[model samples]
Target: MRLAYVHILPLEYYPPATNAIRIFASMDDVDAAVWTSANRKSLPEFNCDGVRIHRLPFVNPGTSAFLRFYQCLKWHWDCAIALRKFKPDAILYIEPHSAIAAWIYYRLLGGKARLFIHHHEYYAPHDYDRPGMKLVKLGQKAEQSELFPRAEWISQTNESRSGFLAKDNPEIAAEKFQIWPNYPPLSWNRKSTQPAINGPVRLLYLGSASFHDTYIRELVEWVARFPDKATLTISGFNVDPAVWEWLEKENFPNVQTFPQGWQYDELPERLHNYDVGLILYRGNTLNFVYNAPNKLFEYWAAGLEVWYPQEMKQITHLQEATTQAPLRRLDFNELPTEGPFPRPAALREFRSDYSCENAIAPLLRAFDL
Candidate 1:
């Protein structure tokens, strides 16, 4: 099987896309290729871990709504042209926009390719009510009316999000919807034998940071309140400018920031040092309320305890199901005020139950690979 994975963003920046491409390419019966775009001046075509990668020319839609709309159309055209040339047996659309492009390729251009869709975020119709999102809203409408019914498989990160998607599109068959959580590859799993902490607990937040509608500010303040008992590290590629400005002005002694975050490959070694991993989404939207991000499994793979918001129904269900990692729920209103923070004993050993290899088993069975 020749499989093409289409995503509108840089593949290296999105671990989920990279993970899927790698897994598909590694299969004995499948030949995988990635069709993606980057804003850089030059990105040569390359092969990564058995998968061929093709980088399409991309225009950075800097803050301008017109440019953003133009860029979206350009990407759809590029993707359709590339898919027509590749003529893959199956195409995995990384998001709705990519699926829209695939729909154009097969429906309008008379291409023959089985369509599969994987959504990283759940967007309700109301989510695109902004003026700049007219194109996106139309694309989503097409996805529901055309792509969803036509797709052989459609997946979300968790059951809760999948339920939301199904609820929104009742015309689609139930068996077409599947769950593919964001789990790290088994190679990234680490066995940590660190003894119980005799010093301040090392807490880490290792993803995008945004103050608006997120608990980032509250988390930082809470960590700062117990500087003598805990130390916090904020690191990611998408850390907001305001976060850095506030950090510089406040100058919290125990807090550390890594604006230039570590590469995805370095996570196993780098994350093993942290005692706890934080998920700080405030659940402001239904999409967020059912959040089950890759960080949760990555934390478990690295032998770190997972801490997430109480309102994240997906994470709460996962915590209840898994005994391999210590998962805790945080209530921002009732935070501990004193020291001697409770830490689990030696970190649990790496468990196969939490690996990407395990998570993708159902997907493989569904694909009949």
Candidate 2:
């Protein structure tokens, strides 16, 4: 079966979870391709284990989405062009704008192929959708203005987002919207060798260090409380010099800074040695509240505890890993200071289910290829 997929954040196969459904959906005997805007080495085209990926590439260089609205519009246009060229048997539209691209493909193909939308982040019931329902409705019109109906099947990652999509559009078929859990990768069996508990335990914060989510000062202040007792390691993106200066001023004496990246596969392997991981997002907006950050799963992959706020669902979902330890106010007791219940079986289950096999089963069934 010839299948095409599209997403907003480009192709990221290395971090495992970034390409979870991609790996599962295109697993065995399914000839598939991908189309995305985020440019990462010929991804959507990588040959891994036994999968063949072909990404329809479109680059928007020197372009800035000074505004969020225009950014989505530019993304939809690029995806539409990419779909028109690849013409696969079906399209799994993973992002809002990409769904519009797939819809245009269906219209041009005379509905010969199907279109499916994957929803990883959706607005909860009590709250307005991400950016609010007002913005969601606004986005709907913007995409419909380009493609006729936009999406055929909306596969929600969880129930919260699904309800919002079907709440007003009950006329939409029920089968088109199904539940697909976001199970992290199956590397859980490989637990990090526990570091010396008696010595200072190593705690880490990985991924983007931008000021948007975590202000450097807040983390420094939190670490200030643990100068001699705990050590915090920093990685992801080059550490800004200003952040380094601030770290010195905060007097986090034991703090260590390392190059902020690893060969995508190297992280889980490296994580095995750390005691616990830290997630410090300041906002409680839809971006933070509805997020199932891949890092949480990666933390699980390493069998390390995660220090996070109560607002984080993934932290709450995984009983073994996530801790309610507040970073700024801080409490080390909330962290998993001891023990390793190696969960390889959990990872095997997660890999099998989240492996492109289980994740994309619905899309494959929908197309009947």
Candidate 3:
């Protein structure tokens, strides 16, 4: 079987995405290709395990939101041309931009391949909920055009999100939607639950710092208050300069910032250096409440106890999954003060059901692989 996989989002960082690596690995026995893009500032080509990658051409001279959108549209057209040339039997695309782009291409320019989509975020009817606004109306129309009953296969990051989508759009069959949580890769499956030393408890906060999760700012504030008790290390790309500037100016002895993040392969080892993994989001929006985060499992895989918001609907499964990796709710008043920390054996057991291999099993079966 010939297969085509397309992802319009930037894949500039490492460890390579779980889906990307899985697709490429599977390519060895079948005729397959992957189409993706990178920031213009980075190298234009990538090769993984003998699988060929086609990087879409997208040149954005400025960082403005409008320019980025325009560039992505151009990338979409470039992908469409490549899709026609490759003409595989089936195509799998990632959330938001890639899926929309592929659907547009298929609708405007004919294609016979069956199309599948994965939703990392539960994109509910935000604009449609408030239809009077001009931009909201446009947003609603665009979303409807791309994601409806037509998708051959649908996967979501968590059960709550999938259930929400199925309930919202009853026309789509319940069987069509599969729960594909943000499971970690095999490399992160290391389990070593040595207690976080009695000194300062090391904490990690990775990914975007500016977005929701006002609790992160609160964490920083808490660290500022008790500089000797715990140290927070912030890493990842696109962090707000102001946030970093404030941290630097304060020069809090306990807080450390590494704006340049470690490579993806380095995550497992890197995570072991810290005592706690933090994935906190303000559950103001339904998406936030229902979303499944990648960092949640990444921390557990590396055997670090997790601190997440109690309000998130997905917390139930995470709490139920492990005993060795103590799941702590984000507490403003204090950090984990007492431990002989739980050994990582239970978290390692939780890893069994939540790896890329298990997450993509249904997809492989549906594709008849």
Candidate 4:
């Protein structure tokens, strides 16, 4: 049996478990080829476990949102052509973008392969529960209607998505929507818990593109007051030079900014050393809400307690101890001052389910491998 995997989302080798379903599937003898988009800036290919990969061409010259969308569309076409050349018996697609496009292409082209999709995000609007967020939800639901039923079957990471669709759209079989959470690569390992930084905690701001620069500004405001006690680190690729220079120029006593420019497979090692893993995302867009962030598990794999407002869907496995919301304005005025942050015991155990043992089963069963 041969499978053709296609996606344009980011890819990396370390954390071993990052995008692990694709990595592990590629490792199996039945695994055929993986066709995915390469970095927008450079194309470097390493043997990702055992899968043969084809990187889509780098086509972005501007950072406009429309241009980025065009690049993703262009890369999918590139990936589709690549898949046709490989001629696998089946196609396994990743969520958000993969399912809808593949369905349109497969129907139009009439390929011999069957198609399947897996979704890890439980996408909701940033203001989902508010009256103002109505139009936002409408847009998302419309997008879902266009895409969700197109799949022969789908695997959702959280219960809400699977359950909502089964009720809202009965045309799709209930069984087609199963709970499919991310599995860390079987190679992922637990790291020693990183003790919080002394004096003040070191906050890590992780992002993929320039979209998250706003969060860094908020961090600057918070850190400006506690420069003696706190420090912030921003790591990601494709950031503007002006943003970098602005942060440096401030020369705050407690802030240092570094561009963690695209290091795959090396993430686990790099993350293990950080004091706290920061997951600061602000968006009402489809990509942000439906996200069962890979880094959530990656941070756990490295055993760092995360600092976010609340847990995300599909990955609230803060089985051990977790901090409370609003680190920006921590209001512990009435509480006792002398206790530990009150997290659960060891994080190593909570991370186990995210490892391949739990994550890979659904993928295997999906293909009957």
Q: Cα-based RMSD of the predictions, in order?
A: 2.4, 6.4, 4.0, 6.2
Better of 1 and 3 by TM-score: 1
Poorest 10 consecutive residues of model 4 by lDDT? Answer: 325-334
Model 2 pairs in collision: 10-38, 24-356, 24-357, 25-356, 45-53, 189-344, 192-272, 236-260
Per-residue alpha-carbon lDDT of candidate 4 for residues 54-114, written as tens digits (9 for 90 to 100):
7666446567666765665667666666667677777877655454346445644556576
Q: Would you estimate the TM-scores of all the predictions?
A: 0.93, 0.70, 0.84, 0.71
lDDT of 1 by residue, 1-369 (tens): 888888876776678777777788778898888878763423233347887787776666564767867777888887888889888988888776566678789778887788888888998868878666676677787788777877899999888889889988888999999988888998877667677687899999998878875688888888888878899998887778898899889999989998877778779888878888899888889888888888888888878887888878878887778755578888865676674275767456545356677887887776668
Best by lDDT: 1
Q: How many times do residue backbones clash in model 3? A: 2
Q: How accurate locally, in lDDT, is each candidate?
A: 0.80, 0.54, 0.67, 0.56
Residues 81-187, candidate 3, lDDT per residue (tens digit)? 78888888888776655654576567777877877777676766663454323332342354456545566788887778888877876767788888766677765
TM-score of 1: 0.93
Candidate 4 regions with alpha-carbon error over 4 angstroms: 9-18, 25-28, 43-46, 56-85, 99-101, 120-152, 163-168, 193-199, 208-214, 238-245, 283-292, 310-352
Ranking by TM-score: 1, 3, 4, 2
Identify the runs in model 2 with alpha carbons over 4 angstroms from their true place.
Answer: 13-18, 21-26, 38-85, 108-111, 123-139, 142-152, 168-171, 210-212, 238-245, 248-251, 258-260, 317-369
Model 1: lDDT of residue 108? 86
Per-residue lDDT tens digits for candidate 2, residues 1-369, read 666666655556334334554454545766666555545443343444433344443434445534555556555566666656666667666645455555545555454556566666664434434342443454455344533244557766655556666664565666667766565545443544554355555678876655555545555555556555567787765455667666657656767766545555567577766766777665456556545566765665565655665555544544334232212222322433332222222222122112334555565566675
- Which of the predicted structures, 2 or 3, would earn the higher lDDT when compared with the native? 3
